[model samples]
Target: MAEVKSMFRDILSKQLPVEDITTMVLRKPKLLPLKSLTLEKLKKMHQAVQETTHQQEMVEKEQQQITH
Candidate 1:
């Protein structure tokens, strides 16, 4: 758990490079198997991206209203 927390800190602090994100993920700890979980996570992440894009559009629209 400490390792996981340290990894998150590295990510949040940008101490880890962009390429290292892939490295960290692909080289995940042996305790948790992720061969199939990664794919499922990717799918869920795609959905989240879509939702965030929609929310961003709504916020932009509201900002336009506020300006005018």
Candidate 2:
């Protein structure tokens, strides 16, 4: 009975491994001090272009409905 208990304990230890998990290195993100003027201007231009395209699509849809 004692030998049987020792064998069971050995099996349990083998099935369940014991070890410390590796931890990831912590890092801090770099902060930007200011935004670029050129980039801001480009973003505004892109938004204007998108609005113009949307307006044109709406106009085309209106004309199609009238013709049909």
Candidate 3:
């Protein structure tokens, strides 16, 4: 479906690794619903993922600095 393709495109554009996306979609069947997803909602989801990843990286860096 077009909505599914669009969702895949949005996920890819977020720079998520293909393996992770594949695993996530497989594990969470509810991720792709029958209803159409809005662009705004996709963008928000991407932004949230980016922010969470950034925060995680920062925390890891801080931990490494402390160890070194």
Ranking by TM-score: 2, 3, 1
* Structure candidate 1, residue pairs in collision: none
Candidate that scores best on lDDT:
2
Error of 1 at 18 (Å): 63
- How high is the CA lDDT of each candidate model? 0.87, 0.88, 0.86
Query: 1-68, model 3: which lDDT tens digit per residue?
Result: 99999999998798966787676333644566655668768988999999999999999999999999
Model 2, runs deviating above 4 Å? 1-34
Q: Over the stretch 1-68, how does candidate 1's per-residue lDDT look in tens digits?
A: 99999999888887766776676434655676556887999999999999999999999999999999
**Per-candidate alpha-carbon RMSD to the true structure:** 24.1, 13.3, 26.0
lDDT of 2: 0.88
Candidate 1 structure, TM-score to reference = 0.42
Minimal lDDT window, size 10, model 2? 16-25
Which of the two, 1 or 3, has more lDDT?
1
> For candidate 3, what is the lDDT?
0.86
The regions of model 1 sitting more than 4 angstroms off are 1-35
> Distance from true position, residue 39, model 1, in Å?
2.0
